[model samples]
Target: MADKEATVYIIDLGHSMGEKHSGRKESNLDFSMRYVWDKISTTVAASRKTWTIGVIGLRTDETNNTLDENGLEGYENISVLQEIGPMSMSALRELRSEIKVSKTKQGDAISAIVLASSMIEDFTKKLKYNRKIILVTDGKGAMDADSLDEVTEKLNDVGIELIVIGVDFDDPDYGFKEEDKPKLKKKNEEILSRLVSQCKKGVYGTMAQAVEELSVPRIKPVRPFKSYDGPLTLGDPETYPNAMSIAVERYFKTKLAHPPSASTVVVNNAPSRSQVDDGDEAIEDNGNGLGAVRQVRAYKVNDPDAPGGKRDVDFDSLERGYEYGRTVVPISDMDESITNLQTKKSFTILGFIPFSSYEPHLSMGEAGVIVAQKFNEKAELALSSLVNALYELQSYAVARYVNKDNQKPFLHLLIPDPKLESEADCLFDVPLPFAEDIRSYQFPPLDKVVTVEGTVLRTHRLLPTPDLSKAMSDLVDAMDLSKFGKDDDGNPTEYAPIDETYNPTIHRINQAIRHRAVHPEEPLQPPAEILLRFSKPPDELVDQVKKQIDILIKKADVKKVPPKVKGKRKRETVKPISGLDVDALLGQAKRTKIDPENAIPEFKQTLGAATEVKAIEEATKQMGDIVCTLIRESFADINYDRAAAHLGVMREELIALEEPDLYNNFLRDLKKKIYQKELDGDRMDMWRGKIIAGGLGLITDQELEVSSITEAEAKKFEK
Candidate 1:
């Protein structure tokens, strides 16, 4: 790949080459010619074999003159300066100098590419690899859909990398005209994006600056054999050999070690042999640490014919002398009686009792005494029960279970002592010693009640205390009496006149009084002293003084005038001299002169010199005018529409190659005529009109015309 050769073909398709931009002597084509020439020359000089170069010009079909053998072709391919070797600077310069600025009729960019592809086809076929065709255009293509696709496919098949360098395609102000807008112009952006995607080496640029940016070389990473030992790693770990083995070895070799300890010992004691009985029962000591014990009790296994009658070794028989011990004691009658007593009645020896008449208590008298002795205690207990019941009621309300058919709030009454229960029963009306007083309470209606624990009668019997009349009367009396004051019509009036004593000062009062009073009829006046000090001068007095001065000046002028005199003499007329002819006098001088032949020659020479001098001066003056006109035109905003119309006229003049040399010379001469400073305004306009008409194929031998041309001529002019 590194040894392969790369060829880049650059084509310029800007409409400025069509001779219609900025009204300047140098068209965009001219600039492109110089620009690409320099670029190719430089690239060739730097790396000749590695790079190949090509160039093409693009314009609309209306202005281009060069054509293919097939008449009225849309595109023209200019010859490229081929094989510009690294050492051939002179050849490059020669090629650059040979570049001619010609107009193209078909500025459509598609035609430009087709022409460029045709021209570079030979060069592309010869190259084995890395072939590239870079288009440097102002984004104007006009080939038909079929031809465009064909040309594009051809370029792609040849493995030619197409790089488009779009230069100011959207800038109509630069060179492009509005009328030249392509039918497929809207797809230009999408086409450029697709081209870049397909070409792999293609790029779009809006300016020379963007072109420079695209030309910058990209930097590639250098693949290294070893990875760096740092916080950030960017190499593949798999490339390193025995990495896991090295890690395991490093781990085991660097670990610490320790030793083990000894075991513990325990002692056992047994009864002596002398303590065993003689014949009553033999004793034995087990070596496995069982103490010496007499076998006074022994049970035999089941034997069918054994002593006393087939004794079966029953598990029940093993307890003949030994009684089975129970961990828990059995209940005696007295204990059972006590348990029954404990179960039948609950003790109040230790439990919470409310100290309030409203809450559960020992007795009403006791509750009353507690409430009197400890008001906060009774109140706290009562409030806690009320709040707890209310909380439960709220829960029932939220659950929507209150006052439901089966769901009812229950009240539990506890009477640890019969005396307390009897007292509770006497206060209430239930059958139990302790009765629920809810019978007297009137509960809220079924729907309204969140939880009904008692009868509705209790709720009705309980009434809220009536408010104190004296307190209500005092509150009413405390309100301001002025707020209730009314007018005679019985309508309430505003509160008593806001204390005027605390109102504004006397100066404010005066201001208010003045604001209410009607405006005076007389004109407002400043103080008399102020008027005297600042009055304007009197107009009548000043006018009177000025009039008197005018009269005095008139009188002085009348006195200074002098009297005029009248008298004159008439002059006589002179007669004409017929003998003294102007030509004869000049000729006699010439005849009487010594050395007449030399004099004649000198006179003729002098006359010729004078005539030449006058002519030169006139020419210089005309050149100065041309220079000024050109300067003004260059700086002036170009009328692109007019210039484009004139370009159409220019395309008509250059028709066939019958006088190819003459046509070329005429074009060169036309360029010089338009560019020269000596051309007058009318003469320049005439020459410019001729050039435009010639280029547009609108000109004829009968004095170059500016009118429209036939379609055939227009098509020919387009090429």
Candidate 2:
């Protein structure tokens, strides 16, 4: 299991591959390609540079391999579809198109294997790479058995693994045996079996079995990387007399993994001439060219002397700068180096504190394990003593860690975890936040309200009452999940175990990608039940808390607010319970004017007294005249607010009466007269500040039903 791999697939592309085999609707070539596509797609999804792939088509119509091109014999009808290199989406497209049935079914599988071996060996001569050769065939074409021994020895010497897959081949173990198979096909299968058997590392199996196992999910093995490895020192070893050091190594205990991010692509309608364009004839056009889009950036600054009032600058001409208060301080590369804090690689302990004094919430980032040096008995004993002593005292150590020379220093907390019986004598370390990383935000007190006079009240509306508190506590108690589920023996246990709850975001994305790769045509299935197991509360738990929830809602006085109606507004006025005539009786002697001294109340009473649209219209005219007179006779800005308030009331009353045209027309005339200085010498302040700012300019169709006013016309009128 090496990190670097060089796997080449020798796919059979003979004429017979285009034909169907035993009860399968798809051709043999398409059926076998399911496995190849899945494997290659997985490698592409990983996006690793070390995982490379090569494809060699066997039993092709032409000869275009290294062996045949070099004038060597017995290597015809074989082509090198793709060179061994870093596999990407572009290379995958080329390999897929290169795999097609040939007109002539005359080629040797053994020769194709040799060709693949030479390509792999030439590319990875003495380097450390996991070399593998996979040959897929229906065994219908010829396979020379003369150089079997030599090829087997060469593969073993080169340390290459061989795998041969036969489509519709006999396999007693798989409960499949093709009846009445051709003589040549049987002989070729036997030859392939022997070739795999003689090799040191090989696997000979039927293609059906391999394709069936493609749906099973596999876990990728990761190589362990050390985050830090140095001495754990208490006090400066060179400065203190009681200083001590323990040789130790550190490895990740909880490493983070990220899901694959989606890339932006654009479908090109024509051939692209850009250098980074990915569309070519090798990829299927599907009636439209598809290419990955690339992002470009530019920098510009405003310049009065330049054309278009802007000047473009090259990115290389710019220097990095940081903000200092209200100004930016530019620092050159040389100046930055002088200001940077540099340190050497070391792990030194600062001091120890009681476990009670150290807060668990302060520890952040990935956790790691600090262990004694490997195969060093003295270091192991010394570290073990430290672990046990810290464990007994219930204390933790604070340490300063520098990963490498010139690297930034970080604070870490190391907690003792000693269980020698299970060989777990180690200290777990987690990164600690600096003072700059800690955030302190002040929030208002939840239990009491403080008045402006420094009086503290605990019985305010924001505070919960005794019955409300009790009801909440009862609801919380009923929703407890501990010991809620039954175990195998029918005993109560924890409802949701930590190990059984899978991360929905991580697993769901992976499942979708895998399904798409295997079944390109079928719709995606629902997420597995295990992934959604802990998404919601159990039915039994919800049923038991129904009554408690109702009690809590009643005690808290919880009520749902009515939804706000948008677009259209309707005014609802309730009719009197008893037959009465209040506004109608007052309107019998309709007051024709609004008093200037008490205009607001008198104007409101006039409108309230109106019983018909004609009376409402007449009242609006009187108020409008009074508002104009107030602005005309005001001493300065004294009556600006009063005029605005009167206009606001008129606007609301007319809108309620479904006669917005009256207010709109009056406002228009007032704006025109005030701007022209026809009312007095200058009244622009009242017109701009009151009419414009107070939103008393116009009434549109949105607020009134009968009157019509376009939004654009209203804006023009206000302006």
Candidate 3:
């Protein structure tokens, strides 16, 4: 079962909602709140008494003292109808009688959202629960997009999901006149869209969808603990009179929380079979004319890990016990059901396989392959943490069938596989799962899993694929060709470890061959089968990249040469003036004289002369380092705006140093590094924009290509 949940329903009660819509007898306000009540009741039932519901009214009647006694001014006509509480059948039944339509105009949607969020926050304070808000409106109220955006952010910050259900958006056959129907203005739609998008967990739909889906509980997939069921045989056919078969089930021993239970009551008036001891029994007289005695069922309570906690022992059945004179007691029906929550089992290992090898059998196909690969890249740190855990434990893994179906197996490493040396006439085999057999899988909880840092694993979403359409088309064509088959080099299509452990047969054959080398008297081993290896990238693609890199390098070399002076000017030297008498000259020299040229302040020296070549080089190197650091940091943080702004600033600073050519060279170099680093389309586009927006100083206005993938390069790949 899911954790406890809280949902706040913000219903619109404006004059418009009083009119009938979709030819329904109930007013729109009534219909929307009824739908909200249904959702609350359904969620509570589905969650097994774990959900709470709160109701708020938008554009509520200001004069109604029962609903708005506090009369919070500046709240924009929003009023609390029902405080948040656990939903019950009685509460849902009484919801319709409590809500009433208002004559006032619809309240500002943004204000209502803000007010409802505060109510949700106070209710969920110190409580561990999933928070949600359902906004029911006709999408008619005017709202500031910016305010709505802020509300969305705040809700997202507090981990609240906002679901907006717009009524009468598409329905035209309503009881209201055609002119009276809400048009769903573009501005309102846009504001709602932005709100939903920014909320992260937010959802938006029409009234029809809400009616159909709101009552249905959302079922999310959960990871299941797996155990294997197989037959174990013993005794050799020649030595033993008969072979015996034993059933073996393999699973991890897991501690699970006990489900909550309710009290059982027995009345003297009713016939009942009770297990309560006389000493343990407590009786109370009912306040009735008959004065009947009622007995409450007694239960044992203890900490989750306490050994004396309630055990599942059936009083109705018995079996043989380990002791000669003892009998095995059957667990009570109640205890049996609770005991089934926990599990324990055993397994025998076959061999080990890589995660890449295991991924294909997971049933996602081509798209899954790409997603898994991206996940491997994005979640590398988390995977490394898990790998480090194995190193700490000094553990090795082996493949084993995990469940009864036995169609798929996982890498079981924490627990070592049981040895089969004692058993005879036994066969061990691992069957790889076919694509159709692969079901969705979830990782075990962080506490149960062994990881170095206990870092939580994050599942990344599918990234934008701007060029996927073309790539997919090309893939379809390649697959259609009958001649496009296996590689001539006898390589595996997918990555696989080329080691002795990967193939037992190859290891045995090699061992035999080595033995024959030591003892020539023994028969020589047969030739070994060829091992599959990974094929190298096609020469066409490799050469294309190399050519592009070479072109870039040559271009950089050309830009490095300093421009020659057009014409050398002849230098003219002036002779010094004659000196005066020693005494007069000494007096004049002692006097403080400030020339106008000397009084004028001197700015920092610019990089111009050949003598300042070393200085220029140092300055350029420092500036390049700073720029590269900024660019790298911005790209790493995915701050494209910051990166663009920094790039523009660097351009102006570089131009000030009088090294425009050098700056241009740096741009080309940065572009090359970005290309080599494999920045995706979005990053590349931002970099390109930054270079262009910086104007003619930073980069040439000549429209130089920056992505490194020229038209020619793309065409070469097409071939």
Candidate 4:
């Protein structure tokens, strides 16, 4: 089925439906029913094609009146309405009358969905087109969170668009208090938005709005043919105007005459009289005729590899003379050794390169040079490799087409990696000019083209002496160049790999560094530490060491410091140390205590409260410096210039310190969080699948029944 068609299902009826508005005479349910019925009927009548419309109504429980002989229940108590066409307003009226309002339960909305889904299942199977289910209701949804999620998921799975229409949520008359109406409407909007986001093309709106939107049908655009202004001649006549015709004729004759076991003849023969005269006469007969013909001279088509080819062909102009019986020289007779031997023909060499391997930055000229080198050095080996690579790429293209059930001919190219530019250049010195032609070629639409990126090189051609010219020729000749029919969308279908963008080595190195920083490992610890330690010196080294020893002793001390309680009454005030005085004392102490023997005891004695505080401040500052160094070194390793930007030192310093059992707790918490996330994702996926399956009618209530969780189900799956 075409993707454009839409199957719209309009659902109506609910419990609070019957409740009358505070100011209005009509009930919410009555307004919704009439609004939806009128809108759907109008939309159906306006549609160009017969739109399959399924009408269902919702209430709390299933009714015998609604159930058919097949045990399938319709919308509300009436099950589903009978057939209704776009112009069938009476049928819609009849359906409205049949819908009986029942008690609204929490599961009513979900049950209604399940019932509608059942009806849709049958319809979708018969109609493989676009399916849309529009559920028209008031702001109130009776279904619980789990059931709603399940129903929405099912709808999505079946490729059904679920559109919800909430009527009169803002109407104070419909039992919605003026003060709470806005909040209720906002809540409904949020719920609808969340549901729509989960389902493709799903949306919610008022009945009036939805009808207006769905009424507009989409149209497909028409593509016009583009004209080519170049010469319409089949081949280079001056050289081998009739070369292609003769070759084609000979190829057919050989196949017919020889039947099965004939050697494939490489067409090297010059143009015959019959071939050229017939072609010229045919061209002249066309309305846009070639004027008075002059003496036809073969022009030299230069072969880059063969420098010695005679560059000209000669012929009599038709206007000048009706010359006949022109002598022909066979291609085999020409001195094959002469590099400049003129030929009467040209052919297009269509090659395929894997888009993954193609390096867009490498120019055609560069590729030509590489090809030439490879051919010159390793003739047979280079040719074989090129053939194999081309073949593999072609196979992939073919497989892709086949998977899509398309039987069209395609050419897929596996481009060479830019990293292999030097090697490729060395291998194929003279780049085939065709590579440039392809690079400049504009591609078709995305739907018509498929490109696979980031493919790793598996095997390459091994060569002894590469002959660039012969290799290029062999590669060109090996390809099967043939035209095929167009696709359904009227696009010329050919499977060609896209050119791969080149990534600079510097960028790659930077990426590696960034990745390492984010995911540091134990193996990197030593280097990381070295980098940190070398970046800065420990402040007040001697004092810090002495303080460390003293602090450890103090921590070990079971007795507390003397308290100044003074019978809880008389409090003694102590003078604070000034920054200037402390600095002076430290300066004097540093000058006086030069020797370790002198400094050690004095440092210990001076390591009062002041020394301890100083040690902590210095340690924290040093740690910050260390973290910054690690960050800088990381950037440097990747050749990135480190700007003098401040690292959030406080955060890093806090992380660096080994907390009391906090790291262990953090690890446990992290593991739990990861596990929970994974568990949640799996559950979501499962629910999503179930929703789709249910919507498609692939699963029923019996099939969807959840069994008790077993030990196997509880265990996490291994990666």
lDDT (10s digit) by residue, model 3, range 1-719: 45777888888888788877677888777667656655564454443556677887777765322223465544656777777787644454466555777778857777777777787788788678789888898766666555665787789877899888777554333332234544554557667867888887987766765665432223333343323454322343336657433343333333232222323444434223323344556433332112223454544444566687654445335433343457556455576557543322323344344433433333221110000112234233333343344344545335333343423334343222222231211222233445457567886642233347975433322321324434444445433323323454864342232331123344334434333323337685443332211234435445545644444455334355666332211222232356445536467442122222221111112222223445555555554555555556564446555545545554554444444456566766767777676443334554555554434223332323232334454333322
Ranking by TM-score: 2, 3, 4, 1
Candidate 1 residues 426-527, lDDT tens each? 111101123653445666452232336744342322322122333334344443345444676988654344431221233233322222221224343222
Q: By the TM-score metric, which is better: model 2 or model 4?
A: 2
Candidate 3 residue 193 C-alpha distance from true site, Å = 3.6
Better of 1 and 4 by lDDT: 4
RMSD for all candidates, in order, please.
Answer: 57.3, 10.7, 37.5, 33.8
Error of 2 at 103 (Å): 4.6
Global lDDT scores for all candidate models: 0.38, 0.83, 0.51, 0.39
lDDT of 4 at 9: 48
Expressed as tens digits, the lDDT of each residue in 642-716 for candidate 2 is: 888888988887676667778888988898889898877799999888788877878877665455777888788
TM-score of 2: 0.59
TM-score between candidate 4 and the true structure: 0.26
Top candidate (lDDT): 2
Model 4 residue runs over 4 Å out of place are 1-10, 18-35, 46-50, 60-78, 83-90, 99-107, 169-178, 182-193, 207-719
Task: Point out the worst 10-residue segment of candidate 1 by lDDT.
Answer: 245-254
Deviating ranges (above 4 Å) for candidate 2: 19-25, 44-50, 63-77, 103-111, 138-154, 165-199, 204-218, 260-344, 353-364, 373-381, 392-394, 417-425, 433-719
Descending-lDDT candidate ranking: 2, 3, 4, 1
Model 4 lDDT per residue over 1-719, tens place: 22444444444445666777546677776556554544454443333445556665555345432334556533334345543233233344455466656675333444555666656666566557667767776656533345567766787777777777776433233333334564544675566657767777676555444433332222223232211111112244459756221111000100111111222222223232212233323212111111222233344555665559544434431112223568443433234335343332222223334545545454333211112221244443443354355444542111110111223222222233222534331212212334436547676432232337644332323221234334444444433122122456976443221221112233233323333332335232122222233244334433445544444445444376776421121222243555345646567543322132233233223322222344434433443333234333443223111211111222222233222122223223323433464322223222223222223111112322222323342232111
In order of appearance, the predictions have TM-scores of: 0.25, 0.59, 0.34, 0.26
